[model samples]
Target: MTQSTVPPLKVGLVGFGYASATFHAPLIAATPGLQLAAVSSSAPGRVHAAFPDAMLYATPEALYACDDIDLVVIATPNDTHFPLARAALEAGKHVVVDKPFVLDTSQARELIALADARSLRLSAFHNRRWDGDFMTLSQLLAEGTLGRIVHVESHFDRYRPQVQARWRESGAAGGGLWYDLGPHLVDQAVQLFGPPATIWLDMEQQRDGALTDDWFHAVLGYGTMRVVLHASALTAIPAPRFTVHGTQGSYVKHGLDMQETALRAGAALADGWSADTSDGVLALHTAQGVVEQAHATLPGAYTQYYAQMRDAILHGAPVPVTAESAHDVLALIEAGIASAREARVVQLRGQV
Candidate 1:
């Protein structure tokens, strides 16, 4: 069969909130072989602003029932991720869920089993792996520019003095900055260095009117290498996004990836966006002295996630972010939570 003859994969986005509007809907629309078939949102005007011709359903189930929607992208609250994904899978549709895949590893395993039994594609949206800075850092590590790894620090700090009124801060089962940002950090670390041997965590509710943890510090041990993952809502002074110390020297990067910021600013597609401006400073120890240079980050393309999702559904390719990998990410998150509550390091011998 000819490639062009196959119909475009139709996607049903389950929400039109910040995540759906800012990330999923736009990326799905931007990809060539995928179409925004429908959306389940109470705010039709909001969805119409972006997808003028696309269908709008009053509820997600209504959108899922339409055979036109071959895939369902769940961009709802953290607590709803599990049930919504399960519903989408039961409707005989492929699924792509937002990160922190679910509250625990058990839920993730259930979803994974369902998708496998149905012979359908299922993936978690660990889209931060495509962040320009992260991609560049991955390249450097692969090329051995950083020599043997020693220590790593990753921060996703932000300046939010006042805790806003949202479900994320409602201290629910899967609320707080830990679930919101920890998934990204933990997934990135695993991508770079596999799973860790042990993890110790400390979490706090530092911001005013904060009901849940707004700050967290997690230390993960990988053999001799130590990986520290942290995120806070009370940082006036921003920390470097990444800091890597190796035998050769260090690579310190400041500023977050620009793609999310740009998409929120209403860009059509964040392609070919340069990273020269927010380059990471790479320092190497030399015989005479240390040499420092700015390392350029690869352009971030979140569009790749949907593109690969399209391929996996249409061409029988491997899923972009497998449910099992996301399950592993959840293992680390749950471990961190346990570590914080018990005030001890959690071993991952059988956890993952």
Candidate 2:
């Protein structure tokens, strides 16, 4: 495949809710190779309010039919992700599906197969992998500063004691904390340590009126190493972002990176945006006393995802987030649900 990097690709987004409005639009607008060509939403006002120059479609099907759009980004809800993405690929467009790529492994695999048959680029928006704290941990692991990490812990906790009346809190296909936040934790674990031998999951609805699980605790077993991933909306005081233990020493980091907040607050992402440090605390033990490092907060670069997607489409660069990797994440999520349902450990077969 002869890929050219000189030309930018036209990108049509399929939703205008929080994910699209807050995350997708800004990043797509900021990225160089991708233009915000069109968007589909019944809430045309929402799309028009944010992207006045972009064409507006009444439905995703209409968006997919746009001849000028080179890429399609599905930032719609969880249940609609698979079909919408499949439609885009079948329409000969490169596709980017937001997190939890789909509700099940079969859906993910099907999309993979379809994308492959068409030779089109397919990617998942596993953006949390680029979170500042995660990057720091990845750096430490790469440098062997943590020295053969035997244990890893990641938490995405919040203080929402009351379950809000939203689709996410509803007892539906993609509802609840597990589907909402599980992908981030699972993907991070997979990214750092590979797949696990088994997974032990404890999921429950902690709030009084909640219909779905609001809390989740999963232990992904990697033989000698164990990764403990947990998320709860009831957490008033959130736990550390990362707490890693290795044979030689340990490293602990507190607080989520500020880029998401910055994006939500409409901050411009120029001037080394991701390299900024607003929140990070790292403590490592070394022979030269306890080596402590505070990561210069990296600007969250959601735009990088689109840039990579553009490269993959125009230049045949590797898709930043592949469908197969996302399938594995869905498998783990299914296994987690099963583990919690049966009150037994889910035996995972894949390695990394």
User: Which predicted model would earn the best lDDT?
Assistant: 1
Evaluate residue 69 in candidate 1 and report its C-alpha lDDT on the 0 to 100 scale: 83
Q: Please give the distance, in angstroms, between residue 107's alpha carbon in candidate 1 and its true position after superposition.
A: 0.6
- C-alpha RMSD in Å of predicted model 1 compared with the true structure: 1.3
Q: Per-residue lDDT tens digits of candidate 1, residues 80-141?
A: 99999999999999999998899999999999999999998999999998898999899989
131 Cα displacement, candidate 1 (Å): 0.5
Best by TM-score: 1
lDDT, candidate 1, at 121: 97
| Candidate 2: residue pairs that collide | 194-352, 195-352, 274-298, 274-299, 275-299, 276-297, 277-297
Compute each candidate's TM-score over C-alphas.
0.97, 0.94
* Native-to-model Cα distance after best TM-score fit, residue 177 in candidate 1, in Å: 0.7
Give the per-residue Cα lDDT of candidate 1 at 323.
95
TM-score of 2: 0.94
lDDT of 2 at 306: 76
Residue 138, candidate 1: how far off, in angstroms? Answer: 0.8
